[model samples]
Target: MIVSLHSYIAFLALAVVLLAFINALNGFLTGREFQQKRDRSISLAGVAFFHLQFLIGVIVYFVSAKGFYALSEVGIGNLSSEARLLALEHPTTNLIAVALVTIGWSRHKKASSDKAKFKSVALFYGIGLVLILSRIPWSQWV
Candidate 1:
């Protein structure tokens, strides 16, 4: 059940993050003023949703047999590629991605100008989205 919830929320998380990244990139390229309602709120939503997904993912990692248990059961060296991805790569990559998103949020708040804010969000959230995309269990997700 938790794994299913995590999977479902992954869509929301990815959508929001991607939207935030695109919005920021657009704002930066067009030199638009970053509005609290349009820019800040979307970025906040992206960070908040990703954090929620990360929390659920942590729970899934602990409770799901395919997660931590796989590592313990077969040992890291014996894990099949799929098992290694679930047990290690997926969790680790997402954790880093979340950190990047969080850092982006923080940096945006500290940015002196609207362009700087947009640039910070664009760069960090974009990288985070890429990292998250790269490690997703695509075979299972589709």
Candidate 2:
């Protein structure tokens, strides 16, 4: 049940983060005045969802057979590509991605200029999205 929830949250996290990244990028590129309500809300949603997903993922890591168990049983050097991904890369990368998104949100809040806020969201969230994408277990999820 938790695993399923984790998977479902992954979709939400990805969608919102992607949306936030695109919106920020567009705003930055166009030099548009940031609509504080809309922009802040969107970015907040992305960070919230991703952070929730990451928390669930951490729980799953400790409990799932494919996560910590595989890492322990097979060992890092012995793991197949798929096992390595599930046990190590996916969690590690997503943890970093979550941190990046959170940092972006913090930076955006601190930025005085609209362009700087947009740029902060665009660059950090965009990189977070890429990292999340690079590590996703496509076969398992999709």
Candidate 3:
């Protein structure tokens, strides 16, 4: 159940993160004044979904046999490439990505100018998105 939730929520979280990144990039490219409502709404949506994903992942880590148990049973060296990805790389990288997203949101809140705000969102969220994508268990996920 937790795995299913994590699998599904991963889609929603990734989609929102990508959308937020694109929206920020658009704002930057267009030189648009950052409207609090639009910017905050997008950022908040991404953050909320990401938090949900993280919570599901935490549960999955403990509950899914393929998670921590596998790590303990086989040790890192014994895991197959795919198993290593699902058990370790995906979760760790995603956690870091979420942290980056949070920092981006917080920094955007404190930014003095529209350009600064957009840059904050664009740079941080962009990196976060890349990190998330890099670690996703693509073969299993799809």
Candidate 4:
């Protein structure tokens, strides 16, 4: 149940973050002012979804057989590349990715100008998106 929830939530989080990244990039390119209702909400939606994904992922990690159990069963050194990814790389990398997204959201609020805000979102969220994409268990996920 937890794993399924995590997986489904991950899709939502990824979509929302992608939208936010594109929106920020567009704003940066167009020199548009960040509106409180629309632009802010878009970014906030991304942050909210990513945070939810992280929480669900952590819960799943603790409970899923493929996560801590596999790590403990095989031990880190004994784990195959795929097992290591499930137990370590994906979780760790995604934690970092979420942190990057969070930082982007926080920094955007602190930015004095519109371009600065867009830049912050574009750089950090773009990087976060990349990291998230890289670590996803593509073969397993599908």
Where in model 3 is the C-alpha error above 4 Å?
none
* True-vs-predicted CA distance for residue 82, candidate 4, Å: 1.0
Q: TM-score, each model?
A: 0.99, 0.97, 0.95, 0.97
**Better structure of 1 and 2 per TM-score:** 1
Between candidates 1 and 4, the lDDT winner: 1
Return the candidate ranking by lDDT, descending. Answer: 1, 2, 4, 3
Candidate 4 residue-wise lDDT, 4-29, digit = tens: 88888888999999999999999999
What clash count goes with each model?
0, 0, 0, 0
Candidate achieving higher TM-score, 1 or 3: 1
Prediction 1 global C-alpha lDDT: 0.96
Highest lDDT against the true fold, candidate: 1
How far does residue 75 in candidate 1 sit from its true spot (Å)?
1.0
Model 3: lowest-lDDT 10 consecutive positions = 1-10
Write model 1 residue lDDT over 1-142, tens digit each, in one string: 9989999999999999999999999999999999999899999999999999999999999999999999999999999999999999999999999999999999999999999999999999999999999999999997
User: Tens digits of per-residue lDDT for model 3 on 66-140?
Assistant: 799889999999999888988899889988988998999899989999988998989999999999899887877
Q: How displaced is residue 91 in candidate 1, in Å?
A: 0.3
Model 2 residue runs over 4 Å out of place are none
Instruction: Quote the lDDT for 110 in model 2.
Output: 94
- Model 2 error, position 23 (Å): 0.8
lDDT (C-alpha, whole model) for all candidates: 0.96, 0.94, 0.89, 0.93
